[model samples]
Target: MRYRTQAVAYPYWVVALLLYGLQMVFGLLAIVKYLGPDPIRAVLPFDVSKAIHTNLLIVWVLTGFMGAAYWLVPEESRTELYSPRLAYWQLGLFTAAGVTAVVGYLFRWTAGNKLLEQPYPVKLAIVVVMLMFLYNVGMTIWRARRLTTTEGVLVAGLAGAAVLYLPALLEFDNYTVSIFYRWWTVHLWVEGVWEMIQGGLLAYLLIRLSGADREVMEKWLYVIVGLTFISGILGTAHHYFWIGVPAYWLPIGGIFSALEPLAFLAMAVYAYAATRRSGLAHPNRMAVHWTIGSVIYSAFGAGILGLAHTWPSVNRWTHGTMITAMHGHMAFFGAYVMIVLAVVTYAAPILFGRPHEEHETAIGLWAFWLQIAGMFGMTMAFATAGISQTYLERIIGLGYLETQQKIQVHFLMLLATGILFAAGVALYIYDFFFLVPRGHREPTPWPAAEPVEA
Candidate 1:
């Protein structure tokens, strides 16, 4: 809020939260299909609903990331944004493309390649949007002639994400080849570059919320980014195992996949050390809760649960089961979702002219805890369902359909927990849009600005 252009982030957040709410709706619909006979199966089929559910997650999270960057980069660079106009255009184009792709999927107009189901044109539009985003952000930094390591890592991650997505645009006739490259986008994203994005945001949040020394925090951030590349790049081989890849990938995947948790562990330690050194004295207690929660939850969900099934032997049994879903739900929530929420919570007071010292609200607190409890419950539900599935279907050789019937109870748990999670999301959306005041406060310099080396 120190800069006038920072206001551009508000609209982006508004769009992101709206999409988040819509995503929960489709997610509920998708789960309902699993628990009972489909009433609207013909009109809104499970495949379509599931695709929309997954795609919305990616879109809304990306939207949140972009908005966070718009808010953070200006402050980090000690200047206003390079072009707020360009940023708004980018958001409009990206949102339009996302909506078009989702609508197209409803009519069965898709590439039908799992998460990369967006058609060719939609993909191109996405690439262009990314270009615009990077250009605007890059120009902002260049003009300021100052860049912090925290924002540097973040911008690098966003650039890498755009580059990695190029592989998805290529057309491969071989099914195995297509699947191989698909992970380049999907796995490398959530597991690789996306982690860098999470780390950048984490460092920024810790520095702002915990009053952590910027010098020490950025130094350790270097280590976390190193671990991410060391493990994440090679960990792509893990996905290659089940595919028609060489036998060498099994060991390579297992070893590197096992090492992947190191990055998440480092993040957890990073947060802990910061909090330990600088006690939680920040007025934005809600953002602190979210920031700390993101690191701890990610360490468990992304690191521990992921390591559980990612090994070659363990994965051979639980590769495609609800176990992956289990790991995915919590990991995505803790790593990406929570971090974004932390930024939003931290910035809301500044953006809306509310007093920073008294920004924490009862509604916000409930939203945070509800999401934590709900995601934990949902993860357990998926874990139980996955374990049951692995035993009955994979081990006992039960037919898929029969195993599904036996696991209906677990699906019930999933639905019930999913509703809890959805309610939390609803509350968050309401808190952001309705509860937070709309009056604008005059711009003021950040009182706690720290010296930067990088």
Candidate 2:
């Protein structure tokens, strides 16, 4: 590592990987429920398993984001972190709360809100940890007085996400009121502020891997942030379609949410243009692949698939169906998850710096391709199932259970593809954690200082 204090990120990264593996475990279990005769349905119900899967995913990614911030801030500012101890403390506090919340969910001790099930106490703890984290990062930048645009956007996104979560902490007696507020935190995040976080990291990764000019890239950052806010804020109306809101939201949601994809499209173009300008000079082809892949996949998943059913007409048929699940899997995986993994892949050499034969190995490539292929297959399976269900249940007016029975075959296919996805995840975890990098090729030291001749 270039700086000793960068070691603070190591533990956070380790925690992210561990949580990632656990998340996959629960994810497989949750999906397998669709294909069963589930023997353990009583012991581990689908709801609990799915909750754990989703909750773990959120925790792990946020954990990855925290580690990325710790790693990036110091490097960007050209200063060591202000307090490694505070960073560690923040991680511990966050982990303790997360673990407790996960355990509580298994025992039916949740707030019963989808994706916001963490009890009030757990929510408070999250806030505390977030404060500590922001404090450490904010102070580090202030101490150095060398904040870069990349880091500034990232911190703003992090703080905005924290502020958005505040609404979820309170309870509402009315379902309409609750659902209305829920989207404020949920939709506004994926479509709004989190995009800033992604854009910032994307800029950082592209600049380093593509040898892109910092001034030019940050200029692109301003454009992206502008586009995200322009479209994303009003796009919250998309969720307002069926949430007991007025009919006026229908057109507003369709119009604005449709524009939301422009930001993702811009990201893809930005990454590709930057890389092409590099003339493939960077040695680490794997990092380049990840960087470019994140951009394109996010565009397809978040922009294209999201728009597929975003309109009120299409959303009416697809709402609360597997179609949403399909968009969700691809959108979340391609957009947020891949970018986090991209950062890890790019930083792995630094984190576990080793003079290996190739920093980007064939096994790593296999893992990446396998995941992409498997997720595509899964998405197709869901699409087919959702289409059939919509026709049978929604259009044809068949009963919900009857439609489900007719679509069991699709669940079988889902299970099959899910196995492939699981395998890819397993390989990635093994390649990253098990296969140690031995090339700690530190830069050579300069010769001893010599006295200047008079």
Which candidate's TM-score is highest? Answer: 1
How well does each candidate superpose onto the true structure, as a TM-score? 0.97, 0.95
Q: Which model scores highest in lDDT? A: 1
Q: Write the per-residue lDDT of candidate 1 for residues 1-454, one digit (tens) a residue.
A: 6788888888999999999999999989988999879999989999999999999999999999999989989989989999999999999999999999999999999999989999999999999999999999999999999999999999998998999999999989899999999999998898889999999999999988888899999999999999999999999998998789899999999999999999999999999999899887788888989999999999999999999999899899998999999999999999999999999999988787676766677878788888899899889999999999999999999999999999999889888888888888998888888777655556445434322222
Per-residue alpha-carbon lDDT of candidate 2 for residues 260-299, written as tens digits (9 for 90 to 100): 8999999988987887776545566667777777888889
Cα lDDT of candidate 1 equals 0.91
Clash totals in order: 0, 3
| Worst 10-residue lDDT window, candidate 1 | 445-454
